[model samples]
Each structure stands twice: as structure tokens, then as C-alpha cells.
Target: MNILLDAAQTAARLPWAPLVDEIEALLTDPTVQVPPRTVLPMAAGAFLFAMPGCDARTAMTKLITFTPANVGTATPTIQGDVAVFDVASGARTLILDGPTVTGRRTAAVSALGARWLAPNLAGPMLIVGAGVQGQAHVEVFAAALGVKQFRIASRRRASAEALAAHARRLGLRAEVVDDADAALADCPLVATCTPASAVVLRGQPRDDAFIAAVGAFTPQMVELAPELCRAIAAQGRIVVDSRDAGHEAGDLLQAGLDVDAMPALADIVAGQPKARDARGPVLFKSCGWAGWDLAAARLAAKSRPTG
Candidate 1:
């Protein structure tokens, strides 16, 4: 029987520690194969994404929709499912909630990047944008990194307060801030989770800060200003999550940074030597990849009920 997991069930299976470990393992696994995702345009600036990946044991594909216009609406902006298949027998096995998988995996990717790239986590982390990704980042970082303090900022004050409340409920200290740029000075960690076309973060980061830019994936969208990206590149290092980031990382692309020349997360995980000043500011630009979804599917598959 094919197993179908809803949002809560899917999330329950993908615990933070195991999910992060799975992603880290696959980062260096040569048998893993993930083709470039295909993006089809829909009316009113929506997008349909088809992402597929496979390993020696399992094959999975995540089909999802991205509708930017649904940001404030009751309907979520992302919706779909991840279908898992048995590679050897070519039998469908499991179906997991798509948005839940995407949220957890994307946040885990950032947490993994921080584990390798972040200089220190002594100070509070600053989160710009209080949407789904923002909340996920807070939860994952706190659970995975033992982070205890957070600062939330968003264009909508109510949203920021809500995220702050959510963080407090997790037994972490959280404060709502008015300016993300100003908060950059005190935070050793920063994450920009907005989907804005223009820049949402400006100014320079702290000398030893690790910033995860996860909002803008397409070449046309950006969260960090071009100048800020260049500043980080010149001062420290900018690591991308995958090779697809060469074209999908808008923050780096808009800044005219040579993404192909930068070190990928896989290289770092493989013990490659640093290419830039390791003690200075660091930025991790994440463009979503199917490999991450595959990792999630692998985890969910382990929880499948047997006859």
C-alpha cells in the first residue's frame, strides 16, 4: 500500500537532527543524482516547479506551485506533494506533504551551512521577514544549533510580533526590531526570508557574522542589495548551497558576483580548503534543490508502516 502523509505527519517524521544529518551525508554521496529543476510560468506571477532526484535506493520528485500573490491570503503560497518510488522495483511507495518538506529541508540546509561556515553563534540571530521560511529558520536553528536568542523584523509589524511570540513559546528570547539593517551589527547570525524583488537588507554585516540569504531564488528576485553582497564577497566568503545557484541566486547574480567561482556547500562538506578569509563575514546563499527533497523523502520512507 502506498503511504500518504499529511503536513503534521510529514513534519513529525523529519526531525531536525536526523534531517540535517541526512542532508550532510548526501552532500558528499556520489551516487546521488539531482537534475536541474524546471520552472514553468503561470499567470499573475505564479510558478510551477518540477524537481526530481534519485539515489541508489530511492527516486523522488517534488511538484509544487509558488504564488507570490498569496503572501497575505489565508491560502499558502506553496502547495504540492513529494512522491517517493522504489528505484529497484519502480513501485510508488510514499507521498509526503510538499510544503512541509520544502520548509523543513530548506531550513535544514541553512542550519547545515551555519554548522560549517558560521564563525560563532554567541549573539542573537536576526531574522528578516516573518513568513513561513522565517519561522522555520528560527525553529531549525534553535533545535539544531542550540541558539537561544532571536530578533525578528518584517515589513508587517504584526507578523514580526507573531514570530517573536512564536519564538518565545519555544523558550527562546525574541524581540521585534524595526530595522533589519541596524540589527545586523549585533547579530552574529542573520537570515533573510522575504520574497521581495528589490533589496530587503542593506548595510554591512558584523565582522564575524554568517548571513543566510534564502528569500530570492530566481534571477529577478533579491533580498540583499547588490552592494551589500559585493561587500560580503570582498570581506569574507559567499557559499552557495548547490551548483544551480549559479543562475538561481539572484542576490549574488545581481551583485555581479561570480557564483561559479565561489565554493559550494558540497566542497566545504568534502573538506576543501577555504578560498577566502574565513574569519571575516560569511554569507550562504540558498537556492532550493531537489536533492534536499530527496533527503526528506528518504527520512519519511523510513517511517512507512509495513504489513
Candidate 2:
């Protein structure tokens, strides 16, 4: 039976709360397998996924969260779909509208990093780029981390104000900001969600910070600036989903970094690469993975009512 996890049914619920424990459990266990993802991007849309094998069959989950931020602003932050198929039999068991999945799951991934990496990271947070990822970042942090203060910074000051107002309606202490460059310095954990051809967060903080630069996979697109990349590189470690994806990613590619030199996030999560040095900074660049979605799908699938 193909099950559809409707967005309306799941709204205003804590989707990622239980998964924090599941994610933690999955993190500690090494036996669980998620195969390398295949990504397809075009002017029309993009899809990313990985297959996590279980015995005779593997669960291949995909998330095609499109670039409809403009359209979704009137509707959802994302308008896409999610699916689960059998790796061996090639049989799909479920499909779901992905606005719910995309909103919560990516945030959970970032939250996992935030919980583990960001230390003494009290928030009254500041988010750069008032878009899908930016707003979602705030929700996951606030819901999971109990963030109290949230400052929204965007190119159009009006948009930032609108986002802040929408956020306040949800009861968050929020506001709009004119300068993203200024916001980065004070916030301990900065999540850069902007999608730009060149870096927007060039002057972002250098002070032993925890940064989740989650966008910019295309060779032409970038989120953080060269200076920010250099700053993080100089500070110490860079953790990625796959060295391959990070290498191909434009932001780091433009930074003149040897992508082959960086380690996979698996290693860091597994403790092969410690989260930080004695006292400096760390950069967690997520070329957001299929494995992450696979993890989230596994969590979401488990939440279904057994009838």
C-alpha cells in the first residue's frame, strides 16, 4: 500500500522531537547503512536521495524540495514530494507531500549539529536570509533548542520585517534587520540559508563560532564568502556529508580549498574528527544529503499508525 503523509494532518506538531533520540541512536550505531545519493538539478527542479539498506532490501528515500521559494511564500516554504522505494525489488511503499518533511527534517539535521557542536550556545538567535531555510532554521532551533530571541536579516528590509511578524504570530521574540553582516558576529550559531551565485555572508563571524552553511551545491551557486571560508579553514576543521559533494560545491570550490583535504561528516559524527580543536572555531558545511533525508524518512515512517 502506498501511504501519503499529508501535510495538513501533521501541521503544528512536533515532528522532529522524537527523532532527536532516533537520530542520536542512529548516530551511535555504525551498522545502519545509507548508500551514496544521486542528485539531479535543473531549471525546473532538483532531487536528492540515498538508499539505506536493511537486509534483503534497502529503503531508498528521496526528497525533491524545489526552488519555489517565491511561490511557496504564498503557500508553503517548500512544495515538493517524498518517496520510499525498495532498493532490491524497486517497489515503492510510500509517497508524501514533502512540505512537512522538508521543513522539519533539514532543521533536524541542523539541530543535530547544533546540539552536538554548538556549545554554551544560548540563543536570542540571528538568522541571515529570510527565506525557506532561514525561517525553518529558526523553527527547528526554537522548537528543539528553546531559542528565545530570533533576528531576521534579509536583502529587502520589508521581507525581513514580514518574516519577523509571521514569526511573532507564532509567539517568538522576533524582529527584522537591515544588515546580515552585522547579525553574524553576535550569534554563536549562525545558519546561512541564502542561495546566491556569489557569497552573501562574506563578513560573517570569525570568533570560534558554529556555522551551518547548508546551501550552495551547484558549481555556480554560493552562500558564504571566500573570506568566511578562509576564516573557517584557518580556524580548523571542516565537516561535510561527502567530500565529493563539498568539492563540487561552489562556495568551497571558490575558496580555493582542496576538497580532497576535508573529511566527511560521518567521521566527525563518529568521533574520528573531533567537533572542535582546543578552543578555536569549526565549520559544518552541509551539502545536505540523501542520507539525512533517509534518516528523516526512517523516523517519519516509524511514526505512522499501525492499523
- Scored by lDDT, the top model is 1
Clashing pairs in 2: none
Task: Looking at model 2, report the run of 10 residues with the lowest lDDT sum.
Answer: 49-58
- The sequence of per-residue lDDT tens digits that candidate 1 reaches over residues 1-307 is 5388888888988988788999999888889999999999999999999999999999999999999999899999999999999999999998899999999999999999998889987759999999999999999999999999999999999999999999999999999999899999899999999976678898889989999999889998999999999999998889999999999999999899999998889989898554333769999999999999999988888854221
Q: How accurate is candidate 2 locally (lDDT)?
A: 0.65
Indicate the TM-score of model 1: 0.96
Which structure among the candidates has the greatest TM-score? 1
Regions more than 4 Å wrong, model 2: 10-14, 41-58, 63-79, 85-93, 204-206, 272-278, 304-307
What is the per-residue lDDT of model 2 for residues 90-114, given as tens digits with 9 covering 90 to 100?
7776665566665566667777776
lDDT per prediction?
0.91, 0.65
Clashes of each: 0, 0
What is every candidate's alpha-carbon RMSD to the true fold? 2.2, 3.8
